[model samples]
Target: MMLFGHGDGGGGPSPAMIESLRIMQKNVPGLPDVVADTPERFFKHAASRYSGLPRWVGELYFELHRGTYTSQAMVKKGNRKAELSLRKADLLIGVFAQFRILHQNAA
Candidate 1:
């Protein structure tokens, strides 16, 4: 998958964000190989292969800074829920490890 971010730091996307995307694609199963490039590079690539392309590719805009002071309660609740989920995941991991060890010993 080719994800076009404004390359060379033209846009707000930092190098760390690009690297994180690469790492996620690498570690995740069934995820396509991701290539992060500038808009100019993607446009050039599309132009070179114009015949096989669609009429238009959609655009997305993200507002990184939004005033959310009113949603503090919601944010806190979400954080609490996430913490509970992580605790549950930790417990499951411990159980899985114990099971694995037991199975190995039995074998």
Candidate 2:
């Protein structure tokens, strides 16, 4: 998260995000792509279970911002809801990211 922001000082992605993705993939073993990238679709598909999400999470989405807001504490990474680093996010959204590039397909 810090790496996504300009003010966290030093840069790239946090180690935690990387490991989180590894674990999720490890656990699920080839999770699907279309399922992860389209959260609205996911939310609707699982509405009964997820309609309770905070309004912000359901309303907002993923986008890459290059710099921090100079005046506001809303650092480049601030106020992000479904936000994930592009690297982590690509993987988090699953199958969309070719982390290992070892296989042409992953679930």
Best by lDDT: 1
Clashes of each: 0, 2
Worst 10 residues of 1 by lDDT: 60-69
- Residues 1-107 of candidate 2 have per-residue lDDT tens digits of 01232235566456785665556655475754222234565557677777776655453434544433454565544545436556676675566344544344555
Report RMSD for candidate 1.
7.7
Candidate 2 deviant stretches above 4 angstroms: 1-20, 28-37, 50-68, 72-107
The whole-model C-alpha lDDT of candidate 1 against the native structure comes to 0.70
Query: What are the runs in model 1 whose C-alpha is more than 4 Å off?
Result: 1-18, 21-29, 39-66, 83-107
* Predicted candidate 1 versus true structure: per-residue lDDT over 8-103, tens digit per residue: 355865688767886876757787666666788878987798867666556554465344445577887899899999999888878988877444
Cα displacement (angstroms), candidate 2, residue 23, comes to 2.8
